[model samples]
Target: MEDVLELYEQPYDPQQPVVCFDERPCQLIGDVRTPLPIKLGSARRVDYEYERHGMGNVFGYFDGLAQFCGRN
Candidate 1:
């Protein structure tokens, strides 16, 4: 794990930018019921219920150099 963590310390190299990637399985969900419309003086309200559509994979990547100097 230390070896992986150390990759973050690498200096930014425009010619060879260090990159990190990860993927997470996520649930796709939506409101089971339509939200109640908001009125003049009331806050819009949504139902607490949700419906799962299916499973999804989310992928993300980061440029080590982009955050080397806290630029990102």
Candidate 2:
């Protein structure tokens, strides 16, 4: 990250363009119904099976001179 910043500052042109690349991973969760209620005193209940929806990876690009406010 520091290397990227240093490279951008070397040429130093306010009119020129610079962009940063970053990514984030997001997890999807599903709620399952329990067979026993907590008040019944029968050891908590949880489902052994689950369905996987999908995972997401978000890629974001930011304009260095634009207050870090650019997305694609």
Q: How does model 2 fare in lDDT?
A: 0.67
| Candidate 1: RMSD to truth | 2.8
Q: What is the number of backbone collisions in each predicted candidate, taken in the order shown?
A: 0, 0
For each candidate, the alpha-carbon lDDT, in order, equals 0.83, 0.67
Clashing pairs in 2: none
How would you encode candidate 1's per-residue C-alpha lDDT over 1-72 as one tens digit per residue? 999778766666666778778999999999989999999999999988999899999999988677766766
Best by TM-score: 1
The list of candidate 1 runs beyond 4 A from truth reads: 10-16, 66-72
Residue 42's lDDT within candidate 1 is 93
Index of the highest-lDDT prediction:
1
